[model samples]
Target: MFSRTFARSLTHTRPSASLSRACLFYTTEAAPATPQLLVRIKADVKDAMRSRDKERLAVVKGILSDLTYLEKSPQAPAQVTDSVIQILVQKSIKRRQESVQSFQSAGRADQAAQELKEIEMLKVYLPQAMTEQEIEDEVRRVVKEQGATGPKDLGKVMKELGSLDPAKAPKKTVSELVKKVLGSL
Candidate 1:
């Protein structure tokens, strides 16, 4: 009896055009809203695959994987930007640098060389690093702007510098420069 009723209901019902349209609207896949730089990187990944460049492919895939994981997290930004990519690249380079150091200490020159190559590949994506003179100039400007008169005000100047330029200025270099500039005051 239940099967008979189910068959009868199926035969009686017809999906209306409006209902079909609504379903299509809901079911159709939306275009990926990836940033331009990310799109370029993805294209590069394809090229790397075609060329069978294992090292480049691995680095690019790792970046995309990190992006995917970050997007899945609750705290991720609404839209991934190039700046986010830069930050991720910087972190990767830092990790590889540490690995290179450990490998060198262990006398594993081969592994250390591999890490160094990866670091160089990753560095290509980051913006041009600020020269020492440029960083020093920026530090001086921030120090003067904030009226940071001594080492006591180091935190304030550093905080301002971070906002002024986050990715370009190396933190250690900036701190040392800030100290030298502030100490003179």
Candidate 2:
């Protein structure tokens, strides 16, 4: 009788409320949704095609292709998240930058210019980079909070800063800044 009454109450409750309660109790949460960044990038591919913007189309397609490859590989995460996409974009930019340098060295000005354009497009997706002053401020804050003193504490300060701003503070820049701040102590 008690079981019947509880079940009846659940059924009689407002549909939305009952559904939420059922979901919460069952512990069968829905799978994570696709990250919005991936959706936007996919949409841009179509827009580029429609507008006949070959350069934009090429850049977005390259990004999507990289994503597909990663998805199939053993190293792929269970679900592709925005951070994964951002990291991919960063790597793509780095590769293109190197290509630009190579092209410039070879006196291929036109090829180098093309690569620079693609780099600008890719940079749109990444979060704004931290300025030098901002990096210095962050390093100092982390150092103070962690009570780090001298070069010995560099690793501790870096670890905390990484957690705090993984996307904004470029690792190499942050590492250099950390060392500078630590040296002062």
Candidate 3:
């Protein structure tokens, strides 16, 4: 009897219910996972499918295909960052814009309109664009910073503007703004 009591006393006591519960809650339930851009794209793709939205579904599928190609390409980077994905999305939009212009010039209004719709659909993945006045102000700032003298320095000014926030201002918009500023100067 004495040996049994001694053996029981030598063992460690169980953790309190409150302590165990707190630890479990803190470790397992404290921080919820935030979805990455890819996860969000996949979710939107599923939603588009469910809603039977062919336009949106086609755009999302195109984006997924681009991303998948990046993953499979031998020269692809170790990881695809959100910024890279955004750049790809911007390129896709630019391509559609070009096609829209081409179709319009060819007097194909219906095809041009369809391309514009696709551009609009893809733009949901891009960051919000800046206003015309805002873009001009930013371009002026860049021109002054580069000490651009005249039209000859246009390339230098353009190079500086290209380094601006790509999300807020696209390269084409920035170029147009720079041209207007230089024309005045």
Candidate 4:
């Protein structure tokens, strides 16, 4: 009778280290919800409107306008996922980057600066890009997993990596890295 009570007391008094660690790290509150890119862009547009910031307002509205165009197109998806949004945001930034280079070459530094600012605003919607080191490590792991031994297997290696979360890796950079790794193989 007393043994049962003592055992219960002992259990209450000392949780296993792993259990205690889990309890320490675990959260009761739900993780913050990640809103879609369109939602965030619309919110930013509203904030820009309220602040009378014509520049940011224009950039965000431009993104929204592009989405509307996509929606009206015959090829629009039935549902918009974050990956699609990420791709759209990246494309927009790439276009601006091209414009920035053009403007700089045309001796229009002011316009180039504006484009850079717009790119920054658009970048807010993109997933944080993985570093080169991280990409290299991932490529190595994938090559080993796929038993890719030569440059001829580059496509196979790339396909495996592509199956990962799309927003995390920049495709151009990843492709170049794959070529480098496979060449060394």
Candidate 5:
């Protein structure tokens, strides 16, 4: 039933039909797993395993485990959308950041470095992060659109900005930019 274009789009360079299908289905729905992202992650994981790169392998395994857990959970409902995966990846990144900080504080530089590497790998799948200037511009636009003025209107502005899609504009960056813009108001 799948068209040739769809099938072509699905195939990862690694030759895994199941994974290709998963990638295509998610990307077509505009939710999360783009073919490029799936191919990259899968290839990296395979390379890590082949090269006996324990740290990288562990990171990939952790991500896959999380995906599996989400898949089996009743809370996921009938469809495990790309939006869900994106949220999971965000959470994973946040967790790694926290771990890196903790490891540094505990004088575990090796562990911290590993966590940082994993964070970098996970970030590859994420949409391009907005630069500070871009974020500031977006915040200003949203603030103006909402007619927000002064610090008292911070809540209103934040609510509006937070409603934006993280895939298009990350919420954390947008929040910081909004604060900066509102602070100067």
Candidate 6:
């Protein structure tokens, strides 16, 4: 569900498939050449602007501004890709979550609600996060594969986990699994 113009722009702007693919996994429904997540974000931003959904529009605008700034930054290596965008979105979500907690702690319910709304909006672009069970299963598989037996093997396990495909399994979930497995060890 990507527009031709957007797809063309992406092709022209993005570095290479290998780099981007390393950052994100393409779903079966995604276009071969373009990341579906970016396309969806752009489309939703447009819709929000057109519908005059002020909060959504503002959030999307902020996201876009961040994306644009990142894309244009010379300091960012040439390998920076859509996967980098995914990382940025995750960071934004984390920031929003922290803000929500801080606001609630300060008795600023309105501010907390606003941050929560932004978090919800930002999550729309992230891949479906993996469940704890799924992450645990994968962690077990990795542990088995690496022959990791104790907490001392945590470094090896974490290295493997970091390289594992987050598109196939969410990173945060996998990280938690690593911690749990290590604790048990």
Instruction: Compute each candidate's TM-score over C-alphas.
Output: 0.75, 0.79, 0.59, 0.75, 0.61, 0.68
lDDT of 5 at 54: 89
Error of 6 at 34 (Å): 4.2
Candidate 2 residue 130 Cα shift, in angstroms, is 1.5
Q: On residues 81-114, what C-alpha lDDT tens digit does candidate 5 reach at each position?
A: 5555666788999999999999999999999998
lDDT of 5 at 138: 77
The 10-residue segment with the lowest total lDDT in model 2: 161-170
lDDT of 4 by residue, 1-185 (tens): 57998989887886679997888887788864544766777788899999999998898888778877887899996767778778778889989999999999999999999999999888888888889899999999999999999999998999889876667787888999999999998
Task: Kindly indicate the candidate among 2 and 4 with the higher TM-score.
Answer: 2
User: Where is model 4 poorest over a 10-residue stretch in terms of lDDT?
Assistant: 31-40
- Clash count for candidate 1 is 0
Query: lDDT for every model?
Result: 0.86, 0.89, 0.82, 0.86, 0.78, 0.79
Q: How many residue pairs in model 6 have overlapping backbones?
A: 0
> What is the alpha-carbon lDDT for the whole of candidate 3?
0.82
Better of 1 and 2 by lDDT: 2
Query: How many residue pairs clash (N, CA or C atoms closer than 3 angstroms) in each of the candidate models, in the order given?
Result: 0, 0, 0, 0, 2, 0
Per-residue accuracy of model 3 over 88-181 as CA lDDT, tens digit each: 7888988999999999999999999999999988888777778888888887888888888677788998887766667667777888778778
lDDT of 5 at 7: 90
Per-residue error (Å), model 6, residue 25: 32
Residue-by-residue lDDT tens digits, candidate 2, 38-134: 9999999999999999999999999999999999999998888888898889889999999999999999999999999999999988888779998
* Candidate 4 Cα outliers beyond 4 Å, as residue runs: 1-35
lDDT of 1 by residue, 1-86 (tens): 57998999989998988998887767566865777778888998999999999999999999898888888999898778887877
True-vs-predicted CA distance for residue 91, candidate 3, Å: 3.2
Query: What value does the lDDT take at residue 15 in candidate 5?
Result: 67
Q: Which candidate is the best by TM-score?
A: 2
Give the TM-score comparing model 3 with the true structure, all chains together: 0.59
Stretches of candidate 1 off by over 4 Å are: 1-33
lDDT string, candidate 6, 6-76, tens digits: 99998888577999877687566744455566677789889998899999988877777887788788876
